[model samples]
Target chain A: MSISDSTILSVQDVSISYLAHRGKVRAVSRVSFDLHQGESLALIGESGCGKSTLNLGIIRLLPKTGRIDQGKILYTTRDGRVVDVLGLSEREMREFRWAECAMVFQAALNSLNPVIRVRDMVYDTAQAHGRHDRVQIRKRMLELFRRVRLDPERVFNAYPHELSGGMRQRVLLALGVLLNPQVVILDEPTTAVDILTQRTILEVLRELRAAMGFSIIFISHDLSIAAEMADTVATMYAGEIVEIGPVEELFYRPRHAYTLGLLEAVPKLSVGAQELVSIPGSPPDLIEPPPGCKFHPRCPFVTERCRREPPPLVEEAPGHRVACFESARVLAHSQPVR
Target chain B: MEATTSPQAVQSGWAAFWKATRRALTGYTARTLLQGLLTIWAVMTFTFVLIRQMPSNPVQIEAERIVREELVSYEEAYSRAASLFDFDPNQPIIEQYVEYLAKLIRLDFGQSITSAGTPVLDQILQYLPWTVFSVGLGLLISFTIGIFVGMAMAYWRGGILDNVVTALASILFGIPNYIIALLIILILGVQLKLFSVAEALGRVDPTIEPGFTPEYIGSVLSHAILPVVTYVSATVGGWILTMKSSTIATLGEEYVTVAQARGLSQWRVLTAYVGRNAMLPLVTRLAISIGFVVGGSVIIEDIYRYRGLGKFLTTAIVARDYTSMQGVFLVIAVSVVVANMLADVLYGALDPRVRVGKEQ
Candidate 1:
C-alpha cells in the first residue's frame, strides 16, 4: 500500500489466544485487514466469531488473560510514520491510544464516569495526550459537542447517567475524536441504543469520519447495519474471516457460503413473503476446532474435499475474496444469495 | 391547559419516595431477622451456660480464697456470694430460669461477687469506652489506609508500586495481631522507651493525677500506640486485599471499560468509576468488622494490658466473676446488633439498588 493513500492502520496476520480452563483457546485466528482513511470497515460476526477479539487485539486492549499469540499491528501516525502498536510499551501504549487511535466501546451509556461531568471526560483525552492548552481543550470539547449535535453548556456539567443513551454515545464519540486520532474503532457502539438513537449515532459517526478523515473499524453483529455504514465488510465465522469484499459485493454478491447464509439470515423488509433464513448450526468450539474446514459442518454445499481440508481465501475479483472450496459450485447451484 | 401543573406530578413525587424506601428494604426476610436473633440468643445463652458450667464453683472458690487470704470468714464469704450472685445451689432449674428472666427484665445484672459489691453494669460501662476508643480508632485508621492504598494499587496494577504494596500487605496479613503487638511493645516500648509497657490505665502518673490535660492525653495516646499499631498493621491487610480484589473486579466491569473508552484518565477512572463501585463490598466488610470490633480486640488488649472490655472479660473469666461475664456478653450482643442495624441503614443509603422495606 502507498504511504499517502490514506491507509491509517494495517493488521498483519494477527492471532490472539486466551487462557481458558481447557488449555489455550484461540479467540482470533490469523486475522488480517486494514482501515483506510475516511472509511469504515465493518467486522461482521456473531458473538463468538472473534470480531471483538480482533478489534481488541488490534488495539492491544485485550484483557490480562488474553495474549497476542502472533501479529503485527501497524498504525500510520499523523506525521506520516508507521508505528507498530503491538510493540509499544505500556506507557507508550497509553500515550498512543487516545491520540493515535481512540475506541468507542459498545454500551457507551455505562462507559462514562457517573461522578464526572461530560466535559471533563472529553477533556481527559486531550490532557492524556498533552495535545492542547486548558483553554484550547475546552474550546475543542465545546466544538466536539457541537459536532456530535449535543448542547455543550447543558452536557458540560451533566454526569453520564444524566444523559440519554444516544447522548452518552455521542459524548463517547466526541471523546474518541477529541485527540484527532488517525483511526477510531467503534466496537458495536450503537447496539445498546434504541433504533432511532442507533440511526442518530450512525449519522454522527459518519459525519465525524467525513470531517476528520479518520479510518474506522466498526464492529457489529448486525450485518444490515454494517452494510449500511461500512465501505468494506469482512464476515467472520468461528474466529476466521470467511469472506471480505466491498460493501455492495459482500451484501449483494456474497461469494462464501457462510457470508451468503449471514446475508440470508437478515429479515428482509423488501422481500414481503419470504421466510427469513438462519444459519443451521452453531459456531465451532474454539478450543478444539474441526480438523478440516471449520464451517464445513454448517455449509450446505459441504463436499468431500471441503470436509477433508480447509480452504484458503482466494481473490476471485479485485478486492473480493472468499474462503470456501465450493464457492463457484454453490453459486452455480443456487439463486444469487442476496 | 396548564402544562406545568398536574395532579399526577405531585402523586408521582410521593410515589417515587415511597418506592425508593420500599426498594431500600428489599431482600430483608423475616427468616433472616429470626435467624439473626436466634443466633445472637444462642451465642449469649451458650456463653452464660459455659461460664456457669466451669469446673470451679464460684461460691466455694470465693469462700476458700477469702479464708486462705484472711480477707473474710467462711460465713461472710458464703453469705456475700449468695446475696451478691443469688446463688442457690439447691434451687430447681425452672426456678433459676424464672429468676434469671425476672432479673433480665428488670435490667438488674446483679453485683460482681469478685469486686466486693460493684454493680456488673457499672463495671462494664467503665471499661466499654476504652475498648471502643482503641479498637474503633485502630479500625478507622486501617480502613482509611486500606481504601486509599488499595485504590492506588488497583489504578497502577502490574506496576512495581502495586507489586510492593501487594507483597507488604500479604506479609502483614500473614502475621498474627498479638505477635505484631508483642513485637511493637518489645521494640518501641521496652527498647526505645518511647512508651510504657503494659500498664496503660488511668489519666497519667498516679502522683500527678493529670486527668484529661494535654500531658495526660499525650501519655494516654502514647500508651495506646503499640496496641493500635499492632492491631491496624495485622488487620489492615485483609481490608486492603478485599478492596484491591473488589477494585480489580470492578475494573473489569463493562461500565469501567466504558469509562476508559470515554477517555477517562487512570486516576479519574479509579476514583469515580472503579473505587466507588468497588467500595460496596468493602463497605459491607467494614460493617461486619464493626459488628465484631469489640470481640476482635481481645488479643490486642491482652498484649497491651489495656483496661478495655476485653481485659475486663479476661479478668472476669479468671476470677469466676459470673455476673461480670454475663454483663460483658450482653453488652457485646447488643453492640453487634446495633452495629449491624447501622450497617443495614448505611447500605440502603449508599446503594440505590438496595430496597429496605421490600425485603421478605
Candidate 2:
C-alpha cells in the first residue's frame, strides 16, 4: 500500500496478454506487487496461472506473441532514479537488462548456449553492459562459481553440455548475479534438477542473495520452496494476485479460497492420514472467463452475489491483502498446520 | 621370479597392442573413414561395370560410324577404327578388369581410349580447376547470401521479406539446375539480350592468355557467368529454405532468449547464439554439396558449353572414352569420400557435442 524509499521494483496495475489464434488470452491481469531491496518475493500458483508471465513481463522478455498490454514497471536504480522499464529505448533496455535487473529462466538445462563455453558467456554478459575489463570479470566470475560450489576453472572452460543439470542451474544463478543487478528474477530455477541438487541450488541462492543483497522475485509451484526462500509470497490464480502478504501470514492465515485450496492440496507431514483435497474443476479459460468472480465456479464459499460481482483486493490484516468477499470467514476457517 | 615375469610382460605387451589396434579400427573417425572408402570403391566398381554395358563397345561404334560416313568397306572401317582407338574389343572383360584394377592400385588411370595415347589423369587435371572455381564460387556466394537472407526472413517472419523469399526459394528449389541454365540462356541471352551466348561459351576467350591479368580474369568470369548463375539460382533456393527453418528452430531455443535477457547486442546474439546454432545442421549439408563440386554439373556445364570437368565428362561419355570416364569417376569418388571425412572432422570442431573420443 505504501511505497518506501528502499522499494526497488514496483509493478503498478500490470497486464500481459498473448495474441492467440482464437483471441487474445489475458495471461496476467492487473498484477501489482512491490519488491523491496534485499527482499525475496515468490509468486506461487498452478500451471497456466500467469506466474511466469508476470516475471517475464518485468524483464520484457516475453515471446513474440506475448505483450505487456498495460503496466508501469518502475525500476529504481542504485542512484535512486526511477526509470519506467516500458519507457526505456531498445538500446537503453539492453544496457538496463542484466546490468540493472537479470532473470534466471526456467529449464536451466537449455538456458545456456550449448556450443559456447561458460567463460565466454560470462564475458559476453559483462561486455554487453560495457564492462570491458577481462581480468576483473574473470576474477568475479571465478569467485561466484566457487561460491556456487562449482570447480571454478573447470566450469569456466567447460561447455554447457559438459555440466550436470544442477551445475548449469548454479552457473546460470552465478551468471544472473555476475552483473550485480539489484533485482534478480528466477522462474522455476530448481524444477529440472534432482532433490539433492534442488537443496544445493536453494542454499546457493540464499548465500548469493545474502552476500550480494539483491531483491529476488521467483516463480515457484513448490510451496515448501516458497515457504523457505521467500520473505514475501504472492498467490496468483487465474492471472490475478488473489492474496499476498508476509510468507507466514499468507501461508498460515490464507484469506482467499483458492489459496486455502492450494494449502490443503499439499499433503502435510504433521497432519497424517488426512485426505489431500484438490480444488475441483480446472483453471478457467482466459479468452472467455466466467463473469464476475473467476473463482466462484470453484470456490466453496460462493454466495449469490459472487457470480454477479468481482471482489476487490482489500487489506485483511497489517501488510496482508486478499480479494474475497468472505475473507474474515475464510481466515477463521483456516487451521494452522505447523 | 625374473624369468616368470618376463614371459607375462611379453604377453601383456602383445595384448595391449591388439587392444590399441582394435580401438583405432572401431573409433568414430576411423569407422567413418573406413565406411567412406568402402562406399567410394563400391560406387567406382558399379560405374565401371555399368558404363561398359551401355549400348556398344567403342571400337564397334566407331567402325559403324566410319563405314556409314565415309562409304568405306566394313573390313577397312573395322581395321581403321581398331587402330585409331587404343581399345582391343577382342580382349576378355576379365583380363581388362584385372589390368584396370592393377593400374588403379598404382593410382594410374592409363591412357584415354578415344584420344589414343593421352593420359586420362592429365586431361582431368586440365579441366578440374575451371569446374572447382565456378561451382565453388557459386556455392560460396549462395551459402553466404542464403544464410543472411534466411536469418532476416526468420527474424521478420510473416513480413514481406519472409513471404516473398519463401515463395521464390520454393519455386527455384523445385527447378533442375540444367533447366535453370537453359532458362538463363533463353531468357537472359536470347530474350533479354543481357549477354551474348556465343561470347559466354567455354571458360575463357581464345585471345585471353592464361595469366593473373585483369583481362584474363575478366574474360574467365564472363565465360563462367552463365553456368555460375545457373548453379546459384538452382541451389540458393535450397540453402535459403534450409536456413530459414533452422533459424526458426534456433530462435525458439532457450539460449537465444537467455542471450537476449543477458543484454547481449543483437548482432552478438544473432551471430554467436542464433546464427551459429542454426548453421550447425546446414554445415554437413554444405560439406556434402562441396563434395559434388568436384563432380561438377555435367548437364549445366554442357548446356553453357563451359569447358569444366562436367563438359569433359560429357565429351568422354559421348566418345566412349572408358579410361577418361573411369578417371573422372575416381576423382569424384575420392573427393566425395574425402569431403565426408572432412565434414565429420569439421562438425566435430564446430560442435563439441560430437567431438569423438573426448571425455564424456
- Give the candidate number with the greatest DockQ: 2
Model 2 clashing residue pairs (backbone): none
Q: Could you tell me how far off, in angstroms, the CA of residue B256 lies in candidate 1 after the best superposition?
A: 3.7
Model 1 docking tier (incorrect/acceptable/medium/high)? acceptable
**Alpha carbon lDDT of residue A110, candidate 2?**
94
Alpha-carbon local distance difference test for all models? 0.79, 0.91
Runs in model 1 with CA error above 4 Å? A1-4, A113-120, A131-155, A162-167, A333-338, B1-133, B140-241, B259-276, B287-295, B298-304, B313-360
Error of 2 at A120 (Å): 0.2
Q: lDDT tens digits, residues A1-338, model 2?
A: 33579899999999999999999999999988889999999999899999988887887889999999897999888997888899999999999899889999998999999889999999999999988999999999999999999999999999999999999999999999999999999999999999999999999999999999999998999999999999999999899999999999999899999999999999988778899889999999999888888999999999988899998999879989999998877888896554
Docking class of 2: high
What is candidate 1's DockQ? 0.26
Report the lDDT tens digits of candidate 2 across residue range B1-360: 999999999999999999999999998768887898789889878888888888877887788889999999989998999999878877887788889989988988899998888999999999999999999999998999899999999999999999999999999999999888888889988999998878888889988788899999899988888778888999999999999999999999999999999999999999999999999988988898899997868988888788889999998898788888989998999888888787888889999988878863
Each model's fnat? Answer: 0.32, 0.88
Q: Model 2, stretches more than 4 Å misplaced?
A: A336-338, B1-13
TM-score of each: 0.71, 0.97
